[model samples]
Structure formats: structure tokens, C-alpha cells
Target: MCGIAAVLNLSLAPVPHLRPALGAMNRLLQHRGPDGEGTWVHPRGVAGFAHRRLSIIDLATGQQPMTDGRGNWITYNGEIYNYVELRAELGAQEFVTTSDTEVILRAYARWGADCLTHLRGMFAFALWDEDRQTLFCARDRFGIKPLYYTVVDRMLYVASEVKALLPFVPEVETDLEGFKDYLTFQFCLSGKTLFRGVGELPPGHVLLARNGGVETRRYWEVYYHPDFDHTAKYFEERIRALIQESVAVHQRSDVPVGAYVSGGLDSSIVAGLAAERQGPGFKGFTGKFSLDPAYDESAYARDLARSRGFELHEVDITADDFVGSIEKVIYHLDYPVAGPGSFPQFMVSQLASRHRKVLLGGQGGDEVFGGYARYLIAYFEQCIKAAIDGTMHSGNFIVTYESIIPNLGSLREYKPLLQEFWREGLFEDLDQRYFRLINRAGVLREEIKWEALGPYSPYATFQ
Candidate 1:
């Protein structure tokens, strides 16, 4: 929703170039936070922080790089859904504005680092403590927002995007391990990023930079303990409640909000919910590719939008458009994330931006629910393996001639990798194997060049 950047001088040198570097970074992210920009120059012995605000909350007064009464400065880039509740709890504190940014500052002032536990929603923020001379930065629990940083020559540089930090760093190099992970898992998993020396602050973690040393630690994780006791009805009720709550929080924007509608169940569900909440004539946006039938899902989107009686804006993207936007997409991404989906996503975002400053997307639905087709394949594979083993209760199967036979045709390209999986004690567990089957691109190793494959091979360890 916004962009944040900070520089901590570990060399203890005067930072005359700090403002210039931040300005360049902010310029790159103007699309993200076009409303306003603010900078905080630490007095004498502290770090500098900058913020580009989109003004979603308390648009009139929620300007940043905001500081508390005690001079503890913070430049926040996120929406804290529970800020109003937190404000109520902090009864006696003299309030300056009705923004979540101030609530975050006050909460940090009272609870210190422990404040992260009580808050909810997506965010990445940098807080500078003048008294302690420490800098604390954190990313949210789900990674909905991004934060990339690098420690070069003992100087800690962080920003909402990697492009912002590029100007400040002397050189740019690829991180081979991260590239390999990207190839293996379409996404650069967790902390690994494509740029050498540049790393993403993993979700639900905090990083502290102090006295030329950096320490990173996790603060939260999603617990996967299966709830076997809950019935289908109970689970549905809980899911509905969570979805409504999440949607409500996401819709807390001062500007008019719109939805991106694809024909898929996830986007359709989001559009439906948004339309219901906002009343009739809600605006929806969709992107259609002219040459790619495999990529076209516009009809479904149009049908859904029509059924909901909402106005739909459709953009027909051609190959030329795709080629022209590739560099811009890569630049905005800060790292290469190879996926056909990103193209349409960017186009849709562009179209949505024309109508609304903020748009709600139906991402994360497939991951949360068992919506992907790969999950179904994994389930079928498990059943077949169980049947072949002739063990009624024992679902696990040992490596044998028939185990890989059925999957051979579809997984032919990954045969060597599959063989290696068995050889190296990988994919032995059912869940791990399932994840591998779902996440991997089943293309033959020879089809893609070694150079092309360089980025994704490291994740093969997990497969």
C-alpha cells in the first residue's frame, strides 16, 4: 500500500547522499504510493528513514516519517486492522491523528518488540530509537507486503522494494542459490532472493541493526496442526467468518476500492463478496490476452461481472504489450519471478489503477483451501500407491517398479529428479512428496538450458 526506506550508517560516516538515494528509490515506487512522501533526517548520531504514503487511513493527517513525543521515529508501510482497538486500550496517550501509523508508534513505545504479536494485517515498518541508537524493522505474517534489504560494508540499507536499494549499493550480483530456488519453485521461497547480497526479510520476522551488527529472528508462523475434531459445517462457518473479517479489513481505504475479477472461483468469490458489501454497480477489472487461448479467462470474468450487475473494464493485451512491459515488471518485482501469471496481473493492476487507487485481489485462496489441481493429483497418487502395496491401512509405499510407472508419462522429464529424490532420501514423506508433485514444472531437464535452469535447481533438495 505504501513504500518505506531506511539507511543506517554502520561506518559512522556523514551520510550526505542518504536523501538522494531515498529519493531515487521513492521515484521508482511512485505507482505504489503516489499520495505523499516524507523523510526523517536523524539529528547527529542516528539513521535516516523515509516513507511514500498512499493515504489509505486518516488521509488528512496520517503523514510519515512520523515520530512519537519521545523522538522515537517510525516510517510505516501497512494497514494495522486492530489499530483502533489498540488506540482504545492506550486510553491516556495524547493522540495526534487517527492513523494506524501513529498507533504502531505508540504500541511500540509501550510494548517494544512484543507489539507485533498483538497486531494483525499486512505491514513492513522501520522504527528508529534515538535513545537506544537501535533500528528495528519487521515484515508481516503472510508476506502480502514485501521488504528487501542488504548489509554492505557494515551499512544496513532496507526498502519496501529492491530497486530502491540498488542505487545505494555499489554492485549487483545474482544469488545463484536463490535463482535455483526460483526455478524449482516458481517463487523465490521465504528469504532467498535472486540478487546476491540482497535478501528479503522473511514474513513474520524482525531484523535489528545496531552497532554495525544485524540480527534477524522470527516472530510468528502459521501452525499446521490438523483440526480433526472440527466437522465440515464448523470449518465452513469459521472460514466464512475469517473471509468476511479479512475482506472488511482490506476494504478500509479512504479512496474508492475495486476488485479484480477472474472467472476462477477465488476471484469470483472476492468479487461477489465485495459487490455484496459495497452494493450494486461495483466496478471490476479483467485482462485478456489476444493470442493466448490457454491464458484467456476473460469470458468467465465477464459472466461473473455481468451476473453481479457490476461494471467491468477489460483490457486486451497483445504480445507487444507483454514484451514492452517485461522490463517494467522485472523492475517493480525487484527480483525475477518467472511466471506467465505475473504479466496479466500487472496489466490488470494497471487497468484497476485507472479506476481505483486500491484493488482487492483473490490471492492466497488456493493455498489456504485445497483448490489447486495438483492437490487432487497428489491425492490420486496416494490412493494408487496404497492399492498397489496391498496394505489396507499402510498408505506409504516403498520404491518399486510400479510406483513411478503410472506417473512416468506426465513426470517423464523429471524422471531423473524423481529418481534422485528416491536416491537422496527426499520425497519419502507423503506431504513432502505431494508438495513436490504440485510445485514442480514437469518439463524435461534438456528442454531448458543449464543457464535458464540455474536459478531453480537448488530447491531440488526439498523435492
Candidate 2:
């Protein structure tokens, strides 16, 4: 949605490089926001903030380091979908711009950090309070967008992506433990990254930095506490309501919006709901690998588009595409953490950007609905481990997993995965076993011999 950078130093006078460093960080994030760029330095020359915007909402008047005409200033990314409602709740202020960034500033003034409780959309933002002389920063509930920061030489530097921090702290070197985690888990397992000094702002949390010290606190958190009292019919109605409501609100944009349809159940449902609300002539995009039937789903996408009466666009990617863009992809990603899926996804994103500025996808449906094939494999291995160790009767597993919930046709293609999971007595601990399941990549398994990985294992949680 946007890029944000800030430098705060309260305990010492500002250095000459601090303001220029903010500009360099903003340049590194040009991809995140190409619509506009702005930077502001505090009057005392001790603190500065910068913004790069994609111009999704209030395109004309929404620019940052937006100020309240008072001293408070903010540079924010991602949308606050409920701003229209929030604006009403705040009653009449001067109302200079129709931007949600203003809604955030007023809300903070009225409620302080309590404003986070009223927000509903994905976001990562920094707000500067001149009156209190404090710097406040936060990431959204799910960390959909990212916020990275580090403290060096008593000045705090924060940015939307990790690469931006490198300019200021170029002397910082590799993090061996983080590198080990990336090899085993395919991504940094904790806030610590491959770089030694930088760390991420954990999701649903806030940091307040002042006087050369910073304090971080959790503004929200995620927990699973299942309730069984509700009837099946009640849940069905709720799900239906949520689907319609979410699709309608997420389509809130001054610019054109499009959906990424893969023809899978999740993408199909998302596209179908959007088509119903958006009417005919809506646009959709999909990607396919012409080399293999296993990877090609654009045909199904065509069928859905015809049924929904929306315009359909498709892109075909070849091995050459992978070879050419792999370097750039890894550069933008900062780490090759994900699977080959990122390649095709990038092509599809490029295709969609030509038609619409805003694109939505069913990105997390697999994790949310237990749709990943790996989940079935993981559960089956757990059952086998339980049977051998006499924990089969421990009453720890649900009865539905006993028969492989949705029968997977042929596990022949999945054997390499199973071998990787079961080898090295990996199923011994539930946490370690679960880690293997998430990090399961047959390609990675085949490339890196298990013997070399003997000394390396994943930590259950970030220490």
C-alpha cells in the first residue's frame, strides 16, 4: 500500500546524515509506493519521517507527513477500511483532506494508543507527537504489511522493508543463528533476520521511543479458543454474512480494483463474490505454466470468468521467465524464503498492475481452511508416531483425522516429503514435527542432504 521511514533521536543532537539517511531509505522503498514521496524534518533537527504512497484512496489530497495543523504528524501505509465510519464517530474537526491518514491522526489525539483497538484493516504506521516528544509506531494485527527497525548509535531508524535499514547500518554483518533458521525453516524464525542488528516490529504491537530508550507493548494478540455451543446453521449464516461484508468493504478504493483468480475453491469464491457486487465487465487475472498440466489452472479461470461475466486475462510463464526474474525477485524479497509459487505470482501481479492498481487474492485460505495437502501429510505422520509410541489413545487428536479427512488420491508424488519428515526421528516432538511440515519442500529436501542438516534444527519458538 505505501512505504514509511522515520529517524528519531531524543537523547542527542541530530547528526548530519540522519535526514539524508531517511531519503535513502525512502528511495529503497520506491516499489512499495510510486505515486508520491514526501519527507519532513523536525524543527529541532533531531527527528524526521518520510512517506511513499501508492495513491489507493483519496488520491488527490492524501499525502504524507500529514499533520493535524498542530504538532502531531503521521506517515501511514495500508488502508483503514472503517475510516468512513470512524470519521463520523469523531464528529466535526476542521476536515482538511478526505484521507484516512487524517482520521488516524484525530483518533490518536482523542484516544492515544487506544486508537489501535478501533482499527480493522491491515496497516503499519508511525506517528510523531511533538507535544509529548515521543515517537509511536505499530504494525497491524496480522502483519500483512511489514515494519522493520533498528537502534544504532542511539538513533532509531525504521522502514517498511529490511533493505532500507542497511544504508544506515552498513557495517552490521551476518546473523549466524538467523542464517541457520533460514536454511531450516526457509525464513527467519524470529524478528532477528540474516542481518545482525535489524529486527521487525512484531504484529499487533506498538513501540514508543523517546529519550534514547524505547518501550514496546502488545496492543492486540491472536489466540484460539474454540466455542462449540453455536449450531452449524448459525455458523453457516455467519460465514455467508462475513464473505459478503468483507468483499464489499475491501473493494473500497478510489482507483480501479481487481481480483486474482486461480480457479481454486478459495479464489473462485472470492472472484464470484466480487463479480456479484461489481457486476459484469469486471476484470480478473490469472497465471499458468504452459509446461505442465499440474501447474496450469488458467483454463478453469476462463470458465469462471465466463460464468461470472467478467473480463479475464491470463499470462503464460516459461522456464526462461524464471531464469530472468529470479535475481530481481530475490532482491525485492530480500530473501528467497518462499517456494516457486512466488515466480508465477509475480507474473500475475505484473499482469494485473496493467489493468488495476489494487489487487486482491485468496492468499491465506489454505492455512485458514486446512486446505494445504501438507496438513494431511503432517497429521498422518503424527498418527503413525503416536501408534508406535503408545500415545494413540492419549485423546490429543480429533477423531476426524483418523481416516485422512479428505482422501488424498495418490501419495506417490508426496513420498519425498514424507521421507524428509520421518527421517532423523523428526516426529519425536510435536513442535519439531510441525516445523518440518511448514518447512516441507521436496525441492529443498532433495537439494540439501539430510546429513549436512544433522547439526541444524529449528527452534520451537523465538527465544
Candidate 3:
């Protein structure tokens, strides 16, 4: 939602050139924060922090490079959904601004490093502690916002985007390991990027820079332990309640917000619920393809929009548009982290931006629910292997196999799956074989063979 950048090195005062480079880096992220820009350089010339604001909550008062008034300063990106309550809990100290940014600074004053626990939201922030002469940075629990950094000669350069950090670096070169991961998994799995010497501040982590040294440690982890004790009906009611509560809170914006409905079950549910809160002035956005019926879900979206009384906006994207703007979209992405659909999402974002500054959509439903077809294939293979091993009956295997084989026929359309799974490791143990086959970005493509790639490939040594 915003862009934040910082330059830190306590070992030496920041030279005159450092400020220009920091400004350049911050300027590169203007699109992320078209509302306004703020820059704060430590008078001692040791550090500089910059922010690009989108003007979400407190349009007038919520400006970044906000200070705690004791020389400690913060430049942040994100919304603390619980900031209202957090401000109340922090004990009234005659609040100055209504922005969440102030809440974070004050919360840090009270809780120190433990402040991370009291906060709940997506954020990547850098706070300068003038008293301790240390710089503290943190990323949200999930990777909703991005923070990338690299240290060169004790000077730490951090930014919301990897491309923003490029301005401060001497030269840029491909990170081969990141490329190999992309070739295998269609994404970079490691915190490392496609650029050498650049590293990501992993989610749910905090960074402390002081005395010419920086230390980063995890602050939170989302562990999964199924609640088997709870009744199914209880969980169903709880889920419905949570969804309504979350939608209610998110609708608390001062600006008009829109919905992006994909017509999928997940997005429809969100749009439907949000429509309950939003009025007739609410608008919905959807992407359509006139050339492909299979990819066109705009009709279903139209139904939802009509039923929900939403003024719908639909954009029909073509292959030519894909070819033209893909390079631009990937430029904004900083790397090819997403598939071809990213360009459509880019168009969708652009459309949503024209109507409303903020739009809520069911983006991570598949990841959260394991709704990906790959999960189905992986589970099916496990069952078939269990049947062959006599761990499960052959009758169960037949039913599962028959039900799934029809879908597997389309596997030929995907070269990675066929090339990786076809007789590649069939003789190996079931899990082992499937492991080699499953992530098919199952990420197990045979082209990822690193034996002869020598010891230079980071992924090779890593695997």
C-alpha cells in the first residue's frame, strides 16, 4: 500500500552522496505512494529513512518519517486494523495524530521490541532509535508487504521493493540460484531474490542494526494444529462469524472501497458479504477474455454484481495486451514471481485504482484452503501408493484412481508435469517418487538437474 526505504550504518556518518542515492531509491517507488513523499536524514548523517504515502486513514495528519519526539523516527507501510484499540490500550498520552503510524511509534515506546506482539496487521517498517543509535526494522507476520535489503561495507540499504534498492547498489547481476528456483518452482522459494547479494527480510521477523552490525530474528510463526476437538457445526458458525467480523472492520475506511469479484466461490463469498456492508454506490471489477470461453468468468461475476446491487466494471484483456504490458507488469513486480495471470491482475488493479483507491478481493483463498489442483493430485498419488503397498485396500484405490484419471489426462498439456513425473523416479519409494513428481513446480522438473552444474549453484548445494 506504501513504500518505505532506509539507509543505515552507525560505523560512519553518511556521506553527501548517500542522501542523493537514498532519495533516488525512494523516488523509484513513487507509484506505490502517489499521495505524497517524506524523507528524513539523520542530522549526524548516519541514516536516512523515506516514505511514500497513499493517504489511506488520516489524509492530513498521517504523514510518515513520524517521530516519537525523543529523536526516534518511523517510516512505515501498512494498516494496523486494531490500531484504534491499540491506541486506547497504550493509555492516553494526548494523541497528536489519528494515523496508525503514530500508534506504532508510541507502541514501540511502551513495549520496545515486544511491540511486535501487541500489533496485528500487515507492515514492513524501519524505526530509528536516536537514543540507542540503533535502527530497528520489521516485516508483518505474513508476507503481505515486502521488505528487501542488503548490507555493503556496513551500510544497510532497505526498501519495500527490490528494484528500489537497485539505486544504492554498485552493479546488478542475476542470482542464479534464484533463477534455478524459478525454473523449478515457478517462483523463488528462498528469501534470496534474482539479484546477487540482495536478501529479503523474511516475514514475521525483526531486524536490529547497531554498532556497525545488524541482527535479524523471527518474531512470530503461524503454526498449524488442527482443532479436532471442536465440533463441525461449531467451526462452521465460528467461520461465518469471523468472516462477517473481518469484513465489517475492513469496511471501516474513510474512502470509497470497491470489490474485485472473480466469480469463484471464494471471491463470490467475499463480495457477497462485503455487499452487505457497502451501499449501492459500491462497484465491482472483473477481467474477461473474449477469445477464450474457459478463461471468461465475467458472466458469473455479472450475476453476482447484479444480485448484490454493485455497479460492475469489466475489462476484456487480449493476448496483444498481454504481450505489450507484460514487460511493464514484470517491471513493477521486480521479478517474474507470478505467472501470465499477473498482467491481468495488473489491469484489474489499474481498473480498481481508477474507481477506488482500495479494493478487497479474495486473493489468497486457494493458498489458505489448499484449493490448488496440485494438492488433489498429490493426495491421489499417496492413496494409490498406499493401495499398492497394501496399507490401504485396492478397492479404495480403484475408486480414487478412476475419479482422478480423467483430470490427469490434461497433465500432458503441462510440460513440466509430464517431463518430471513420467517414469523419472517411478521405481523409488512412494513418497520419494511423489516428492520428485508432485511439486511438478511440484518444482521437481528434471531440467533442474544440478549434478554437472558444479558446486557453484546455490540451489544445487541447498538440495
Candidate with maximal lDDT: 2
Q: Which candidate gets the maximum TM-score versus the true structure?
A: 2
Q: Arrange candidates, best lDDT first.
A: 2, 3, 1
Give the Cα lDDT of each candidate. Answer: 0.78, 0.82, 0.80
> Which parts of model 2 are misplaced by more than 4 Å?
10-12, 92-94, 381-412, 424-429, 439-457, 460-463
lDDT of 2 by residue, 104-208 (tens): 999999999899999889999999988888999989988898898988878888899888888778586877667667775677765768888888888898989
Model 3 TM-score, all chains together: 0.89
- Backbone steric clashes in candidate 2, count: 0
**Candidate 1 lDDT over residue span 260-377, tens digit each:** 8878888888887888788765799988875778888899998988788888999999888888898888777765665578888898888888788778888888787655545545
Worst 10 residues of 1 by lDDT: 395-404
Query: Measured by TM-score, how close is model 2 to the native structure?
Result: 0.89
Candidate order by decreasing TM-score: 2, 3, 1
**Stretches of model 3 off by over 4 angstroms after superposition:** 385-422, 425-453, 456-463
Off by over 4 Å in 1: 11-13, 290-295, 386-427, 430-463
User: Which of the predicted structures, 1 or 2, would earn the higher lDDT when compared with the native?
Assistant: 2
What value does the lDDT take at residue 370 in candidate 3? Answer: 62
C-alpha lDDT of candidate 1 relative to the true structure:
0.78
